[model samples]
Target chain A: MSKYLLNKFLYTVDRDPELVERYREDPRGTVAWWEAERANQLLNCHTGEASTWLAFDDPEREALVAHDYVKLFELGAHPFLTLTLFIAAFERDHAEPLGFQKEYALRLQHFSLPYPDIAT
Target chain B: MAELAAVIASTHHPFYYRASTARGEDRPPFADEWVRKITAFRETLTRANPDVLVMVGSDHFHQLWLDNMPQFLIGKAPVYDANWYNEEREFGLPRMVLKGQEDLSGYLLREGLDAGFDLAFSNELRIDHSITCPIITLRPEADLPIVPVYTNIFAPPLPQPKRFVQLGRTIRELIESWPSDQRVAVIGTGHLSLELGGPRQFGPHGPDPEFDQRAVEWIANGDLEGCLSEVTLDSLHAPGNATHGFMDFMLMMGVAGEGAKADYVDTLDLFHTMEAYFTWYPSGGPGLSEERACEPRSEGKGESA
Candidate 1:
């Protein structure tokens, strides 16, 4: 499922102010760019030593492009990463405190126990 | 030999920094009560008069990533840079730099590994909110040298609940055996039935109040047998998706010893989660006189926020 790659994308982008804005402004473009350029680059290694086999599957790419956290959750992408990055990307849209978080919870109320496995 | 001054456990809420510091209309209604409870909680550590702090917390995908995740790690750096860009963006936590107790870190790593816990060591670790939140609440002056111990409570394939307790026990033993006269306080932070990034996120209370009630009792009473019998890696999910963080508290329970009731206990029911604080005086609370040590334990409970 390459859930690890999905998390790596969220983790890398969420830590950088420029990337957060870029992903927020253009999810499709950012997802495409990240999958092509950043996916195979080992985080702690030099660019020249980047691995060649890491790539997101079609469903994962579409979910990121769509900014669909619910789909990300269903796909077993780590929920904490998705939530933190999404909050950073979108919490500004709502004026009230915790408004976006409450809405985020309501959207996923369908999920019951044994929620999707997040193990990599 | 070093004295095990105090063993403390708490819930590390990142929102507290922003909530407590917000001014005028920006401040939430719960700020005043939270501050009061934190001030009292801070006293428990201060009264112990510790020379060093052993901070126990979990990293939230900040420095440790999935590719090379360690189950348990100790920071051996001479200094650690605290907080992160995301924490600043979300929680308004100020960036801090704290001195490290490298001698204690070295002792724990060497002894912990020899004691059968394969602990990873970091020479240049940047701690996240899990470690920093307690510092903000308990030791805002940030004067004491610290040894940061990071546990893997976030990632899956985690160590079993018993292992965390065992590690805690080993840490306590190692500290007491260290050939130094310094008094050390071990502080750890974890959650009570927390659910993040799921259907139950941001609820009025923790995702499971019944579980929180029982968990608090287990900790306050130091009922490790009761805690371990009921808690397992798989079972933690029922309380909340993120409830596994409670294992850190179990580790603290190990440090406190079996059947060792806490000397200080407090709780505050804030939105989304419960805030719990606990402290134990292994050597009868260091700075106090003999009569004061025998006095009744102090307890505080806050009204619902």
Candidate 2:
């Protein structure tokens, strides 16, 4: 019964603010922010360590981490161990639908969060 | 005599390299020693040169991840190319032969042991780095026939080490059971050490050599738990080991069989990372077996050679 810490971390942060601020750069859109943030956390988790996880980075893979993060949080499993199980479930069409991206976007626009200081 | 011959686990580090180079983005802390080790193996691979290289790596979420990410998968397509970067960005990556071995692919699923590896084999998905780099490495500008083996390492909640190894053994069983006469090679590619993003603590040149050395030693000896044990935050310099994705190497190491074989050897140190570490194994041998005890092994559909 091994559990993924990411799943717990996301579920915990999905509703709580205290945990979200640890990695969040902005407080606005905290909920939605956590989605992408969680992906970043998972993707870049191996920063200074000699890890093979981030051996190669792809912009698109960021999407996979985000999508998979939310999908796992929804299932409420500890991420690391069951993470692949959840991924397998999604691939097999045996899991829940992933539609959180838009909702997260709406939340971001609602609060103008992440301080998107984009140069337009 | 072996049936399927050999199984491989490989990925497209160069495809990722192409993307990273373009954006001028840097994935830091990938110990140079890791790559150094792999590059050395290239020569041996060239010498041993198997008939078909069984590659195990991850996809771009195109064929699977976006829609679904399987813990493990196999490809049955006859051929595939990078339609996105090649056609769109004009990268000029050659289309690779995914091998029209439907019977083998089908047998891997229908007959291979269900040692807990999930399947997501495909015939339509265009290729990605996870499927492309080996072409360049194996032949270096030559098109070599490859049987694609896809796994979801980048995506969330990847399988635990134990299960992933289980999947590797499944790969061994399936290959050992194959009846093909061609000699086979197993390849696993990805980073041995990696750090992501910018303005971060550890960069490409970051030291932290202690962790890197340990990983090299563990992988060389097929000490998975030893590798994982040392794979902690202090070594990673972050909560997660960016190179954790390289676990595929360990999985492939398991399939390659035995310990400390001189397959892929590292030479140059890229920003303190081993550019490569490669190894070669004798052909015609069967995969791992539970001789003395009933060790949890990778199962397959085999009727003996």
Question: Model 1: how far is A88 from its true place, Å?
Answer: 0.5
Worst 10 residues of 2 chain A by lDDT: A111-120
lDDT by candidate, in order shown: 0.92, 0.46
- Mind giving the per-residue lDDT tens digits that candidate 2 earns over A17-71? 3543442433334434444444334331364433222221332234224543443
lDDT of 1 by residue, A4-106 (tens): 9999999999999999999999999999999889998888887798888999899999999999999999999999999999999999999988999999999
Q: Against the true structure, what is model 2's DockQ?
A: 0.03
TM-score per candidate: 0.97, 0.56
Instruction: Name the regions of candidate 1 deviating beyond 4 angstroms.
Output: B286-305
The candidate that wins on lDDT is: 1
Please provide, for model 2 over B1-305, each residue's C-alpha lDDT reduced to its tens digit, 9 standing for 90 to 100. Answer: 23333333343444323432332233333424334333433445655556676777766434453224567777776665543432122233554444444556666776543645557667665666655666555545445566667766655556665555666667777677776666666666655665321111133342334445555555545565665555532333232234556667767766755453432334234442334454534342333232212211111111111
In model 1, which residue pairs have backbone atoms overlapping below 3 Å? none
Docking class of 2: incorrect
